[model samples]
Target: MSSTAAFYLLSTLGGYLVTSFLLLKYPTLLHQRKKQRFLSKHISHRGGAGENLENTMAAFQHPPGLPVYGIFQARTMEWIAIPFSRGVISAVTIGTDMLELDCHITKDEQVVVSHDENLKRSTGINVNISDLKYCELPPYLGKLDVSFQKACQCEGKDNRIPLLKEVFEAFPNTPINIDIKVNNNLLIKKVSELVKQYRREHITVWGNASYEIVEKCYKENSEIPILFSLQRVLLILGLFFTGLLPFVPIREQFFEIPMPSIILKLKEPHTMSRSQKFLIWLSDILLMRKALFDHLTARGIQVYIWVLNEEQEYKRAFDLGATGVMTDYPTKLKDFLHNFSE
Candidate 1:
């Protein structure tokens, strides 16, 4: 090649590389603004443990004395209930702007409400909800564990599960956050159909930790918004530390995560090791930084941390700019918010 041509080619390649590096290094320069449809200040985890039932109508019948959002579990053709009663209606009646639920597909292609695919934890049965037909599913434990206490027993009147359609039929206006716990085409299709039938595209959100599932959910219904996958969350975290969050185009509209979950080793009397405590501390500093939360909120992404029922934790979550805090005790949250405001 001639010297002149070589010089021009080198300059063009160098310019392209420089531009790319700048964009990656300073993602805030390319921020694409979006309008957030929903903003929740309080989200109840498992419909809030009252009367000892996590997702039962008996529990939900007792409102939190104020307007607070709630999260429920969806299983295969069954709503969350106690042993032999109807509890699906409880979620809609709780008077929250948004209701979050976990969805799983049954062998019969039925989309139901449930948190765990395996029925062992919530229900005494050892079968997977997906493996069993609608009739084969068992009832929930009479006494379920509360979020705050390790082994507290509460009892509710309704124990029978309800169908997913039942919830839609009951609460047409309320927005719902569907957490796709199982990655299945049938489950996705069913959820999409329900959302469409209920005309709730603008109000519902698709939540899954898996990127693949998030993609499928979008493909199934592009109208509904989706939560960021774990990969994107981590990527955002990395970008936050590098100060590139302001320049990037953020597609995720919401972040739903635990404050700081430490899985203790399997043994009696589980406790966090020193390393675990350190990790939690590090996460608090990095993830809960006010600057990070402010940046995301400015970009219209909502931050929601879960399973926090204590007064101090609630204070911390909001102090860090959390749009919403999920709790297992609605009454406690209500009281806290009321007193905090006072």
Candidate 2:
């Protein structure tokens, strides 16, 4: 505890604090901004699930003269008969900046765009997607409940499951965010191959929150941008609180996270147990740090908050420096963005 030793210690601490503050405020001083090919502010969750059937071809575009049968025979025929020359309403037609969908592998090794691994919730079939062949897969329920927005139901003309390759062919130029629902290596490999075959490396982003799954995806194709895994997210938060985020290098280009406030509001607060409510509150406090978001944005990392269907939630996300908002109701979000100022 000599005077000279104490003086040097204090000087070092002061220098570290000053450097950390500067880096926090201006991240580009140390880290170069990453150049991303596609940036989206309005991302459609499950191809605008609230508006359509949730990841059906009909949700993405008007089905071209496809024959209709069963319950949709009368209703679907009217919409399906419309010529492609005439403008039709769909998720793509409505102008979503990006499509956020989940992927699961069929028994035949084909990649399908779906939100659930089990078919019961979406299709009312008691089977896992992995156990069925592409042809054996059941159709989605005609009237489906939206996951993010409770009690809300959506209907679409085409309820058949769509292959990932089909989506790529249909929307060649659109950006897609694929969430790998399982740890299946084959699923990851197939998705990567499709992205490569379509030459959509720049516009397509894929990954799961599992660290192991994210690592496999990166290994499969490092060219495609990956989303942050849960472990990495925790690590980043740690670095931010420790004032070391500026000194660290970030490889993932996209950070897709949920808005905690939205979660609290989605389920009735009175219905939640005290512990559940406290956890949500804790997440709100930890994850809604404006300084952390600003630093990440400065480093050219796009931050997207998820499943925010309301206008106020969208405003909060943007005000917190989020680059994008993923919503089940893309049309609602688009309108909000249109009328929103600043």
Tell me how far the alpha carbon of residue 22 in candidate 2 is from the true structure, in angstroms, after superposition: 0.5
Q: Give per-model TM-scores.
A: 0.78, 0.90
Candidate RMSDs in Å, in order, are: 8.7, 6.2
Pairs in clash, predicted candidate 2: none
lDDT of 1 by residue, 238-295 (tens): 9766655556677778887767632222223346577777787687667777777767
Candidate 2, residues 1-342, lDDT tens digits: the string is: 999999999999999989999999998888899997978999988887776789887767633332221111222222222234444555555658898889999999999999899999888989999999999999998889888887788777788999999999988999999999999999999999999999999899999889999999999999999999999999999999898888999999998898887777679868999999889889988998889998998999999999897777888999999999998776567667766752
Q: RMSD of model 1, in Å?
A: 8.7
| N/CA/C clash count, model 2 | 0
- Deviating ranges (above 4 Å) for candidate 2: 62-86, 90-93
> Global lDDT of each model?
0.68, 0.85
